[model samples]
Target chain A: MRAANERVRVAFQGERGAFSEEAAIKLLGEEIELVPRPTFEALFTSIDEGASDYILAPIENSLAGSVHRTYDLLLERTLHIIAETIIPIAHHLIGCPQASFDDVRVVESHPVALAQCERFFAAHPHIKRVVAEDTAGSVRRVIERGDPAYAAIAGERAARVYGGRILREHLEDHHENYTRFVLLSSEPRVVADGDKLSLVVRLKHRPGALYYALEPFARRAINLLKIESRPVAGQPWQYRFYLDLQAKMGDPELDAALAQLRERADEVRFLGCYRSAQRTEKERF
Target chain B: MRAANERVRVAFQGERGAFSEEAAIKLLGEEIELVPRPTFEALFTSIDEGASDYILAPIENSLAGSVHRTYDLLLERTLHIIAETIIPIAHHLIGCPQASFDDVRVVESHPVALAQCERFFAAHPHIKRVVAEDTAGSVRRVIERGDPAYAAIAGERAARVYGGRILREHLEDHHENYTRFVLLSSEPRVVADGDKLSLVVRLKHRPGALYYALEPFARRAINLLKIESRPVAGQPWQYRFYLDLQAKMGDPELDAALAQLRERADEVRFLGCYRSAQRTEKERF
Candidate 1:
């Protein structure tokens, strides 16, 4: 309905200042439109509803591991991953503009966010934790309520967007927290210089089935970036493995390896082939 | 310290009638003493605190995927997984004895349990959803309040323990929902018939390092039950892998494979060698 030169509408879960929104802005320029959805279900179906051009979804976190619901949704939908981006997660305690760190007596955020800042809570034994649906939304509510005793844990961007103040910074227990996000599009994206390939393969139930499937890539010295085994729904014990491999697009050896792999694997679906985000420099501290 | 014949105390996360309690009873039998801890951290440290002789924790769920926190805690401690058990997860809508299905206006449970009953919630849009810290705790509170408008979602055991009535049965969206838990002990468990081995390995950051590491096992036709790559702390883009392999304890080929694998891997820690849970029959519906 719109020209290709028009701004792309990127859909993400949570409020405007959520991590997914920041990732979309980093990958696509600031000119893109941010479409915020209340839930992952709505975010995944935004393209079909003509509300978005692309969906940026968090696939995994360094500490939290894989986002299972997102992976299951990817399998349910026809969307394809075209690119990916990784961002550092730094949780900050935000409050009203007039609020100070010493005034905070209650904190609220998503359960996972609250759990990550256990050490901070341990230090402040009197502070109570309450759960909220969205991290950024909590910041907005805390500021709107204008209670100096209440604060929320979220990113620094959330404080700026919602006119809140940063009462304290970096409340997470681990400094290595980072989340990986994938950009999904309805139409297939074929990058000529793509070097990373993600595939989901289901093998027949037999001894060494996975080992045999990897032989083709292993013999060729293809680097295996990651391998995750997810249980196949309705079938106990059996699993489907998701592999991330390092190989340039259109490489003859990669083609040969895939052909050889097809014989051993019962089903192999190419989730994507795109440039990896590993080449991107880390965020400056 | 008590003798071996004394009742073994098992530490698990959550209150009584929790899934972990059921798992402990199934693996160690009814003679064991149940020690409930409020959090995973306390449960993992129970042995050092002299509160329990063994720890039982959920490692994976069929629909939800692996519990990353449990894996991380395993790496932090020196505990060894001695055995595993799988249990079916069937959520039931529970209410006070005087409450009926038609009188319920709200439901409360763990977020995971609430998420699993999407179909039931969608059918009853008027019923508000609330999040609770524990599944059985929610049932206990709802029944104690004796509110006909409030209900909790939990297992059948929770209803029996809390004296709550089951308003609805099998509220989970999928019939295949199940959870796998492992029995952990401070001392190594030697099983003469052990057929499964788990190892945490760190390999050099090279293209063929992982491929070569798997060569020894693959050549011996050893089955890889699972493979999970976790990001190494403080090292971005680097990973430490946890592998589950199928092989009898002290098998000549398994020994040869490990000996060869050591040369390729930078570091290898044997988590445990125990019998596989797949040999156990599935729970009858």
Candidate 2:
């Protein structure tokens, strides 16, 4: 920890009132300074540019699955994951403060947000859906336009920040939608309570290569939380598997498993060791 | 074999000259009647709706990975996969026949097509990018507009059918970009040359559920082509894994492994048994 007056600066992609900002605040608290970058490229380079002390990036969503750009950027940068947080994705129809739900004729948002509220769009077929660059930025634009016929789909925080009104709440088709975000820093830090480990492993392109690599962990009965295969950037059809396992930092068993993995696989990279976020039990579909 | 006069009607999603249409013709021959649907839902329902005899759907892309919507629809619909095809994705700058490359100031296509030609767009920053519903449809519209300043990015087939000129060739960032499509019919057909098997399995939430599921195949040195985990509907964090393996329909070893897999997994679903596409070997990065 730094001195009392020194606040950590966290960089995120999108406008000021984006979901990344909410996740960063949830993980790092309100005292941290928010460094909002316009694009993903700018967000990843914020630390190297000395504009931020930490970077908060959205890694995956329950509905959309993994964010491939974040995975690619993680490999490109030398940042280490320090912690993670999950936030429920609640899409609302927001408009200028003077606007009402009845006045809305056109809805605007990121294409994804517009796609997610298919049921609402279907019910109101007359309402035109316009694609915008950013979710929060759509809210900003809607408020700035001050047109009652125009509204945007975004988070509640965006409406508050942009001085917009929530014309309708919970417009998302799925109630269980959630986004998982990871906090990263240039320098690695030790977390005594860390109980999760993430790894990116590349195996030789041969039969049973992945099977042999997972043997060490299987033998130890290590719980695998998630696994994803992503294509290697320069190699077509070849992939690197990303695995999340329940193992704390400094665990001797995990260390032994890593040692065995390194010997069996072509390459193994530790992405992070951090505490797992508490999973919320929601109504099953 | 089709009758002398009775042509097989193949349904695909998009305009007349979409990549799906080209793939359909490449796989089923040019003598077949083409049925074009505006949306994926309509494409999948074309057989049941009595508009077409067969449906062609894109299952995976080497660059974009699996198309999740197609996978979900495959599971939802009772259609059977009878055959498969692969097509190279080559985006071209298409315009009115009289328009030259330098005359274009605006480019339009499906957002994904636009994204794949990032290098070309970056080099020509003066041109504005517009998102359209379909790549082939964009070419149709651009040709209809007959504006020298407007162009669209699409496969060569789109330009051919739409009477558009190819102003620039191979705008795609990667030469290895390809999409794999599966042929679907209401009734299953026996494939004697089938050498590939696809499965969707659900395992109990346990420490080594997946490890045990893969044991039967791993022990036999069977090659696994692809595996993807998708969120189980209604179950927030639970997942169902889809696997593609290299195996024939009636191979004894594969039969034995699948038997063991069924016994070990909570649920196992066989999506299809068909011949694998010819693999292309490129220089290793």
Candidate 3:
């Protein structure tokens, strides 16, 4: 077993000051060694490649819905969720030190960030929207170029990390936007107080099949927190459901419900059992 | 009702030779007037703004999963789906007439198209991938630039429209790639022989709410083709379920099931009942 006092290396997909990196720091702490991978595939295989011990990946966003890439990649790999965290996504207009808000002619950020600030762009129709590979990386590039005409939409951490000036705050259209991330490990984390259970199930292509699978859970009063259907790759229209349930692991009723669900569905995968974080700015690090 | 022989004007979100344009022509034929909108929001409002008679928007892709923007925007509007079409997605490397495969140093295309050709980019590590706004538009720009080093990945139609040369064929990772688009109108067209039904339902926040909603269709042996849950806006963690079923409109059993469903669920929105297209390429334009 690894020592509790040892600093852990966490791998995330992005540059040094990316939103994922900020999330990794918030979940694991600033002392943890952050290993930044360029892509999702690399982040998932980091532990196997002996680069990092664990990974933190975004699973869902309140406004944009689910991150399908993360869900698909997580299922393709043999990883287990150990913990979960929620971070408020606040987009800020960051520019070079000499740039003012009116001096910006081009705005750069990840596609996801740009999409969230649609109203902002609609108002500033003259500003050309440029797509960058990473949010934090965009801030770094514009600052390095020392261009007053270039601005980036990203988190506050990105501005601070890259020493970029904040031209405008709360540039995001909605204030309720938040992203949910999950910490995944190679082994099943023995979560002592885990109350949220995540699983994926493949149902038979027959009428009433899904109903029968949910019977045991509903019958036990177990709250189904979330349910999303994703197409089964190589099968075209056929799909499997991903579920998040509110029940503690090893509970007698939960165990019984799982036993019944296993018999009804063709395949069932236990992803993880972990604590769900409440959305509160006070809870943030 | 308008005459069936009249040439309808159709709007889609992309350039003239985009995959969406290809899909629209496949569904409505070449005689229809094609109106290209710059964004999904504009595409949805084209009818209300009196810019076009109908809009053809992509709903899902086999390899990439659902288009969440289309889903979210569709729910926000009061449009009815009148027809559906599935088009084969084949990515080809297109360059200027003077460019050769060996001369291409940069590949430009929409993020979606670029994502589908991951294997191609992996095989050619020296080629840089740049994200462009549209697939066909990228081809036009690269041809205008007449740069031998610049290439765009798009459908075959783009090559002919912009006078670009096909540098490589079938760059997509999967041969089975297909995208399904829905034709929406301001008023519901009388679709005879419609067999597929699409609807969105909101269930009470309880353990058995969703299971009961599915019971009505299941007991009658109606096939639930798909079910996807998306979070309800303004309410965090709460969701509404979108469903597609294999049942004809006006069928006695379907009507009965829907009535029962309405009584069991909090809210139900009938999106459309239309003829689902077969995936055979022979049925394409």
lDDT of 2 by residue, A1-285 (tens): 457788889999999899999999988889999999976778899999989999999988887677777887888898898898888899999999999888999998987788779799889989988877679999999989999999999999999999999999999988879888999999887877888888999998777777788878888999888888877643556778889898877779988999999998999998888878754223222
- TM-scores of the models, in the given order? 0.95, 0.91, 0.96
Candidate 3 lDDT tens digits, B1-285: 567896799999988899999999989888999999988988999999988999999998888888988888889999998889999899999999989999999999998899889899989999999998889999999999998999999999999999999999999988878889999988877688888889999998788888899999989999888787887776767788889888998889999999999999999999998887853443553
What TM-score would you give candidate 1 relative to the actual structure?
Answer: 0.95
Task: lDDT winner between 2 and 3, please give it.
Answer: 3
Task: For candidate 3, list the clashing residue pairs, or say none.
Answer: none
Q: What lDDT tens digits, residue by residue, belong to model 1 across residues B1-285? A: 688788989999988888888888888899999999978888999999999999999998887778877888999999898998888899999999999899999999988899889899989999998887779888999999999999999999899999999999999999989898988999998976888899999998877777778879888889878877777776766788888998887889999999998988999999898877767635344
Which run of 10 residues does model 3 chain B get worst, by summed lDDT?
Answer: B276-285
Candidate 1 residue lDDT tens string, A1-285: 799898889999999799888889989989999999977888899999999999999998777677877887887898888999998899999999999999999999988889889899989989998877779989988988999999999998899899999988999989988888999999889977788999999998877777788889988999888877787888866788888899987889999999999998999998989888876645343
Candidate 2 chain B: minimum summed lDDT over ten consecutive residues — where? B276-285
RMSD of each: 2.1, 3.3, 2.4
Candidate of highest lDDT: 3
In terms of DockQ, which candidate is stronger, 1 or 2?
1
Chain A: TM-score in each model: 0.95, 0.94, 0.95
Better of 1 and 2 by lDDT: 1
Best candidate according to DockQ: 3
Candidate 2's DockQ: 0.48
Q: Please, what are the lDDT tens digits per residue for candidate 2 over residues B22-84?
A: 999888899999999987778888998889999999987777677777887888798888888
